[model samples]
Target chain A: MAVIHTDDSGDPRLDDFRHLSTADRRPDRPGGKGLVIAEGTVVVSRLLASRYPVRALLGVERRFAELAGELAGTDVPQYVTSAETMADVVGFHLNRGILAVADRPAPLTVDDVVTGAGTIAVLEGVGDHENLGALFRNAAALGVGGVLLGPGCSDPLYRRSVRVSMGHVLRVPFGDLTDWPGGLDDLRARGFAVAAFTPRPGSVPLRELREHAPGPVALLFGAEGPGLTESALAAADHAVRIPMPAGVDSLNIATAAAVAFYELASGG
Target chain B: MAVIHTDDSGDPRLDDFRHLSTADRRPDRPGGKGLVIAEGTVVVSRLLASRYPVRALLGVERRFAELAGELAGTDVPQYVTSAETMADVVGFHLNRGILAVADRPAPLTVDDVVTGAGTIAVLEGVGDHENLGALFRNAAALGVGGVLLGPGCSDPLYRRSVRVSMGHVLRVPFGDLTDWPGGLDDLRARGFAVAAFTPRPGSVPLRELREHAPGPVALLFGAEGPGLTESALAAADHAVRIPMPAGVDSLNIATAAAVAFYELASGG
Candidate 1:
């Protein structure tokens, strides 16, 4: 690990860490489509383990030393400074103590993610970054082999999404299904029964769908307010619903996705 | 409804809604522990439908007109103001356009909530207001009959929790089990099989628990980091586990609870 000791906050080397909140404003910079940031030691460790190339790390000495074992084999420069200097450079009191910036790698093709995947979550119009992140976290925890993002989905690499997902967005394999409902057709061709989740009439309960389709399954989701579009629903082989109590709106999309993933993963 | 036109934000009658963020700072106010507040038409509608006495309403003329039906028979004061005035009174921009203040009714006892309930969620140390709110939302959507708060739980009536829960926290039946782990014995006496959720070995998977617990079950949860305490676990009739992928930490407490609620609700 290349440890660089510096007391200056305005040093040219610290340019990437300045006004961290606005770092993503210029995505056309050298570090791909914005630098993929991982906060704290845990997420930074995951970032280091991921395929994303770690460009640099900024942290207090203790934080860098805490990651010394993980940093030992890595070649990226680690910026060491006092907590005050670190705060001055980052424009906030980052209690996380450490941060890492990485360049976003070339995205995986939908085919790359779908290959040999048994259970996948196909999302449509999930533009809310937090919900997108939570869905990825749930997908990873519940054994969903991959995620296929459809139209109107936010970037999983967005800083807020990465933070909310606890870096699972970095771990889980995902790729944009650019073809909309047509991409869902491709998933079906790959031996997956595309099940669209909605509470509308004529839909089978999710529990029943678990038994009906025992092989590969692609569970489809949409944004919270307006669920799966007509085209997206029509493209699916089945419409499944989670049984919710009366007089309540549908669950948050991520929570709904978690329930579906649990049911499918449990093979119930 | 008793409608009043108020262009002045400094009106003494509007004190309850003044400096709303700091309104709860002094809990020992005229109303017990500050007034329960509901923001937005959707949440205000739930407040109207709730048993809590609606003391007064403040909103734009358009919002008041939208709720004309719900307020038809009620005699509560509806202070109509412009959006800007409403914001001035509330000390923040009111995007929800409407707000309702309710007197906190006497809390229901644990026995009151557990009576005739088939399933309940027992939470310990879930201090995060948003997580508590989301758990309540999940509890409402999934058929968890009620929530039992143990130690370190935050007030569900906190403004943030209410907003984040989509106001389902208002709809859900919840009560504090002040006896801590000893409350488990009381629940067992009420014929509930206490099943604490944790990832420790020797715990039955949540799906298998559904089959094993054919009778009323109390699903136990704790905060995400430090899960249920030993005393809580020891008191449970069984320890239940959600099947999670290896290498990942547990799912967010709310998401995990949602999966458990769904599993128990589906009776799989």
Candidate 2:
């Protein structure tokens, strides 16, 4: 690994780290190279270890020194600069003091995520980056094997999502399901029981989920408000609810996912 | 109820809602009124329904009309203004379209919150307002009866906490415990088993929490990074953990709380 020191904020090698806030938005669009970004030492280390190809790292001297162990194995460019130049290049004061950018690997398949997995999370309309990231973090913690994004989900590889997931987005395998509710059949084909989480009436209590699906389980979650679409719920093998007190609003999407993940993990 | 037409941004009558961003911080300090503020119609309605004394409301005409049923029983002054004027008063562009201010009632005691409760959440060093608020929301959703704040916890009534909690903070009962770990004894005397949540080794899995405490349970939590202080953990009757894959980070404080809340609620 090369430790390149420079005080110039306009260095071309730092272009990948420039204007990060705007650059992260719609990276798939023209003029937007949707590079996977990991912030801080923990996330940076995760990025270095993950399958995603690490492009380079930009940080202050102390942060680079702190990550020396992780850098031992990688040959990625390490740009060391003062905090002022780092902030100028990134278009914001990054308190994390360190960042690692990686190009997205070849997209994972639905099979790639769900293969050899007993428990997985399926999401719909969960467009909030923080919520999506948090779900990955919870899924990782609870031992959920993978995540399958159905529709209207945000990019889990987005910088905000990566940061919020504490870098678990890189660790948790995820893939887009282009067929919408139709794709749920594939999960069922793979012997996964699809359970849609909803507060709608007549849904089975989540506690009984293990009894309902003793084999592989796929817990489906919708956005906080305007929960799972009628089609999504109808398509699931079972509609489950956490059984909250009447008159209380539904839990946040990610928090709800965490609850369901814990229940399924514990029961299994 | 009197519907006052107010276009004046500087109206003294609307002072409670002025410069809300800064006004919400350290309300107990000099030049700070420490009023409980609720933003958005949902939270405003909750503030109206809570035990706190409703001071006044400021909102656009549309939001007022939407909350007509909730407004019917109250004689409090309702100041109607355009969105621009409302924004000017609050010093931000609040899309919530409604706001309510309330005076804190006499504080509830630990005994008061835990008296009839089968499940309650005790928090320590949870100084983040959003996390504090989300924990209350989860507590309400999972049927945890109340919340007790230990040292280093943020004020649940803070404006941001109130909003993030979706107004559940107003619904859930909470009180400060000035005695640190010593106050935990009061809960035990009241027939509550105080279980401190931590990822420390040798701690019992959270799934067996019900087995360990069949009766009432108080799930104690700490902040995100630094978990429960050693003294707090040692003082508790039990130390519980949600088993996770090795090398993964701990769950977010509130997300962990929700998972624990679900586990206990499911077993009960």
Candidate 3:
């Protein structure tokens, strides 16, 4: 590992770590670098283990010590600085104390993610970064094989998302379904049953999902309030709902997805 | 309805809504009024329906108009002001457009939450306000009868929590378990099976929980990282786990609890 000790917050070498609150937004707009950022030791460790090319790391001394074993074989530059200097460079007080940035790797294909998967998550209109990240975290813990981002979905590698996913966004294979409702047919042609989650009347209970599909399945989710559109719902092989008590509109997208993920994984 | 028109941000009637970020903190510290604050129309509406006594409201005219039906029979002062003045009084811009403050009603006992409940949630060390609120929202959506707070949990009535819960914190009954692990026994004596959620080896899988406790069940959850204490685990009738793959630690506490709540509610 190449370790460089520096006290100056203005060192151009620390540019990747600067003004992070807005820097992460650069990835989604025109002429943006689209770099994947990971925060804290746990997430940084995951980034180090991912396929993305590590650009560099910026952190304090103690965090480096904790990650020494993981850093030994890596050749990336590790910038060490004081907490105050780090705060100045980052434009916020990041108590996480460590950060890593990586260049985006080649995007995975939907076919690649689904090739050996039993259960996968496909999302539509899930623009919120934290919810997208939480869904990835839940998907990882519950053993969902892959994630296919349908239209209107946010970039899973966005900084807030990577932080919230606890860096699982780096590990989970996700590919865009750019065709919207039309693309769901691709999964069907691949012999995967598509189940869109909605609370609309006549939707089946989440518990009976296994019976409806009884094979490799794709669980489709929409954003929290607006939910799935009519065309999207019509395209799926099954419409599933986590039966809720009257008056409660719906669960947060990630929480509801976790319940469905757990149900499918447990075969309960 | 007592609709009081006031353009003055310094109006004493708006004191309950002033400097709200710090004011909410007052409830947890010494001599705090322990007031419950609700934001936006959905939450404010729920607060209006709750047993707690409403103190007053501060909002823009549009929000008041939207809530006119709910406010028709109420007599509390509604301080109408411009968005700028409302922002000045509250010390921040609250796009939620409306706010309501209520005095906490008489505290509920564990018995109150457990009574007439088919399934209940018991929490330990869940100190994060958002997590506490999310758990209550999940509990309410999934039809968990009530919530019992054990050691290390934060107050559900905290402003951030109430908002995160979408104000389900007002509707779902909750009480403190002041006796720590010992209070778990009281749940057992009442014929409610106390199943603690832990990922420890040899623990029963969450899907198997219903088989272990077919009747009334209380799903116990600990904080995300450390999990339940051994003493607390031992006190429960069953130690349950949401089965996960190797290397992943666990799900977020609220999401995990939601999975358990769905399992018990669905009887899958």
Clashing residue pairs for model 1: none
Q: What's every prediction's RMSD, in angstroms?
A: 1.4, 1.6, 1.8
Give lDDT tens digits, candidate 1, residues A1-268.
5889998998999877888887766656754446888999888998988999889999998899889888887779999998999899989999999999998788899888988888999999999989998998998899988998899998899888898888998989999899878988888888999999999978999989967788999999989999999999999999999888788888999999989888888876
Q: Which candidate order results from sorting by DockQ in descending order?
A: 3, 1, 2
Tens-place lDDT per residue, model 2, A1-268, is 6889989998999998988988676545444647899999999998988999999999999999898988997779999999999999999999989999998788899989999998999999999998999888988898999999988988899888998999999999999988989999989999999999988889899888888999999899889888999999889999998898988978888888888888777764
lDDT of 1 at A215: 91
What is the TM-score, restricted to chain A, for candidate 3?
Answer: 0.96
User: What DockQ does each candidate score versus the true complex, computed on alpha carbons?
Assistant: 0.92, 0.91, 0.93
* Candidate 1 C-alpha error for residue B124, in Å: 0.9
| Model 2, runs deviating above 4 Å | A26-33, B26-33
Please state the error at residue A256 of candidate 3 in Å: 0.6
DockQ of the two-chain complex in candidate 2 = 0.91
How many residue pairs clash (N, CA or C atoms closer than 3 angstroms) in each of the candidate models, in the order given? Answer: 0, 0, 0
Task: Give TM-scores for every candidate, taking all chains together and pairing residue i with residue i.
Answer: 0.98, 0.97, 0.97
List the pairs of residues colliding in candidate 2: none
What tens digits encode model 3's per-residue C-alpha lDDT throughout A224-250? 999988999999999999999898989
